[model samples]
Target: MSPQGHPWQKQPDWRILDTQFGSGNTFLATWLTWLEDADHPRLLHYVAVCQQPCSASELIKHFEAHPKLASLALELSHHWFGLLPGFHRFLLEQGQVVLTLCVGEPLPMLRAQQFEADAIELTLPHTCQDELSWFLKAIAHCCRRGTRLVMRHADAAETPGWPRVLTQCGFTLEPMKSDGDDSYRQKPSSFSGYFDPAWTLQRTRPTTKTGPLPVLRCAVIGAGLAGAAVATSLARRGWQVTVLDQAETPAAGASGLPVGLVLPHVSSDDCTLSRLSRAGVRMMLQQVSELLNVNRDWAPSGVFERQIGGTPKLPLTWSSEGTQWSANGHPDGDVALGSGLWHPKGAWIKPAALVKAWLNQPGITFLGNAAVTDVRRQGPTWVLSNNSSEMLCEAECVVFANANGAFELLQKMKHSALDTQAQESHLPSKQGMLGLLSWALHAEPEEARFAPFPVNGAGSIVSCVPTENGLTWFMGSSYQPDAQLERSDQENHLRNLEHLKELLPSLAQKLAPVFEAGTLHAWKGTRCITADRLPVVGPLDATDQPSLWICAGMGSRGLSFSVLCAELLVARMGAEPWPIEAKLARSLEALRA
Candidate 1:
């Protein structure tokens, strides 16, 4: 089938065999076709002969060159990179479509593999005209009665040869009308390729499964950035969600910071964490903009990443080709600074405002000061309890969204073992403090938005963000094991001022006139961390206990990972296809479960 044809046009259990795979175009086209069809094939076994397997790096380069195919190509490239030798399989749509890639000589490999196909597609390479007879013979040997073989013959003379070969093999040839026009036949060189047919045929057998569909209703225990996002997604997918928080208002935890920054978690190469974060950041910004008007409460100001002298340890490695830098001259001749893609789409969002927007949706319910004291399964439904020793709520599914609270609950349930044994540890801890300062800036809010700063300095890193109240300067976002939430206005002001002085010595020297007379307001909150330093978002099953779900431990990148994690959880509920990929959705699930 061509890229334009639908793979679901055929029978559900029909096996497809392809002779030639170039640039993986046919495979991609087939995958797209399957996505569009309602009753997709049960199994898709793609057998193609490739002289050389495309390297992971080269696949990425090709995707970069072709902007139109970038999204699909990049996803395929990621899968290709993860492939191992021998038979490799990927389950799509809950195992309805199984893509099996055979990476060797097609004719010999097909003979050795114990599988029969309902249809065979033979793509003759542009350079293999002399070997066409042998290829056709091999294909004929593989086909049985009722098998449909679609062969691509470029020249008119080869059409006669094809029919003759089919007759010799005790098969009948049907001369269907060609798809192209007279002009297409007149200008052979101008034709893009051969005809691609979309036909339907019955499968020889049906594929069967042993288990029933997993149905669940979940709860997210926090209404902060991570919890609110997760709840919104679950509710959108028809899951009953009740958001519980000890605070009077949503986003009263670390997400209480007046303005949270949105930046990708940088890492070397395209590892699982790096890829998930990159995609998560883009998805978060897009969802925020769509749910809440952008540039009003949420606006993405380009981030300025600077290194004054030594090489800095970046969360993600710099992609030399992917980065976008300013052409203007640098302020300091001694510094060699460069800027990469920070998501022109990335933005600073008012966490509280965003949470309220998500909860405003119909299916979501918010319960404040619920303070969950216990969570355990009561029959098939999970029950929640408060300090009063009374049942707070019950649902078929449950999610632990309160960061520290979730950790404590897991410990009590003895389900902590499931998380500790995973590849990416999910143990929680207190890591940092985000302090917000109310400052009177000399410059306009727009001008202050893009001001450059030293993010990795010895003192607290500060940045100016525009809010309805006024221009707010954020500083003293320190990481420590024992830092507590400090609400004292005077102490916060003095700490921010001292930290600002250490960051910009020249400005501090000239700021005596402004600092001595300037008024300030400040507040502090603690950030939660995970053992592997990545957010935990998915289903959990404790030893000898009923299943529980989680969506927490987002750390500083809560704004970046929250929405994506939510969408992932929603898709797991099996309501509909999410905007993100299936593999990524499963990646976020609790691996041990």
Candidate 2:
């Protein structure tokens, strides 16, 4: 496909869907071509489907013939893991190139996509020809007018009625354009066509009719992890993001935690939360690797989980990939005294560092001390005002990432400038406060007997976290539903020591004296949580089009879920390929209650 002269090439973004992906040569070629073109689309999204994906080594070998492309393939191989059954997103070439690899039956996978493709490529196996009509119909759902389609077959005689089937579908056949490699005409057969249906095609999923936004401007109402992540994602997509925070500095809310654990949740049936956590952990780790300093701001030292009463129960169909993420473990006395589960990819991250990094991205503007109290839709744009009714700013859209503050803002909208339909809409939680208490103690270099990595079960203990004073060990995070309720620091410290005693008895014994002496420091924060415990992301109301959105309810997993939820929100707004499956994406929707 030529990057120039095509109508889509002039657009801001171009999407391609491939029915059959064998060895991933086509994707590599397309990515290389996009790199070579100076006037290429701002974003290139390539979606490919395959039943069995090749290993990283196999990919490297496949590109050996093309030496120039081999280096790019090697770079792609770094993120070539965890190809399970559903969608996997890889942000390549500094986030300009997005690859969504769907591992399943091609036809069913095509049906799952939400956006219309600008181009389509087919190289179906012989077995799929029997269901060719159904496959073509599925392809039609993701096609728009003038969408280019190229089909490669073994020979013209092998598929005699293919031209008739193309007409029956929405495509109009055209002569194949020959490049300098004319030798291909003597061997295999290829047909080129464009989607020019005589009748209108009914699409089940919502498609973007207005294309990219004329003005990519957004205002995020929190400067914590969630709001910072939303700002960063939109900024990377060329949006002018203005991040406003109530505090004097970013991450002065729940995201101000010293350190937090990032691990996948496990369940017997692999519930929705479990799957979503896995997706979140993957995205979080990738971001931490890219933006933060390893070992200082974050560490991939893995987590040792103590399965209090019993062993961890994973899904019965757990694959090797699942084991790689989490598996049964029998550790020596140093890590944990008893048997439990081990997460090789689990990490401990300082949330504030990540938030600061996201807010410092190129296209983002951070404005602190701008606590928005009133939000009203004015014409096509949304306006924000402070508690004193002083105007903060106006934008094409507004996202409430201010945890429990979102509920109050939405409540204000119900009686303010919101439309009649929006006024009657249900607002987010009013009881959004969840208090968490954790304590830390300074440790001398010689006296640090804590575990090498983090240990979690009833609670978590992270040791050797670098602080300005020296090395510190953090432990015990007691949960309370009401943030306003009175609770003493000593009481929370004692509660944390109780969990430390269960998680690491020897270490707990070594540090008990500090707790008794009242030398341990207490850190308390209030997290916003929904009743179901999943994050709320997407539109704020059920109108035909929504201008106000919310990304909150991150709870304790903000370090893990913030980036994933942010990307999911931007994906829905731009109609780009989703970061997770549509079902999982919907589970975190803003107004899903």
Which candidate has the top score in TM-score? 2
TM-score, each model? 0.58, 0.92
TM-score, structure 2 vs. true: 0.92
Q: Considering summed lDDT, which 10 consecutive residues are worst modelled in model 2?
A: 180-189
Query: Any idea what lDDT model 2 has?
Result: 0.78
User: What ranges in model 1 sit over 4 Å off?
Assistant: 1-216, 267-273, 313-321, 324-345, 413-466, 483-505, 508-519, 542-546, 572-593
Residue 320's lDDT within candidate 2 is 79
Residue 91 shift from truth in candidate 1, angstroms: 22
Compose the digit string of candidate 2's lDDT tens values, residues 290-391: 889998999999898887877467778988767877878744444445667888889999999999888888899999899898777677777788878788
After superposition, the stretches of candidate 2 with alpha carbons farther than 4 Å from their true spots are 2-8, 128-130, 153-160, 177-189, 204-214, 330-336, 414-430, 433-442, 445-448
lDDT (0-100) at residue 549 of candidate 2? 76
Which residue pairs does candidate 1 place in steric collision?
A: 217-397, 266-315, 266-316, 267-315, 267-316, 300-347
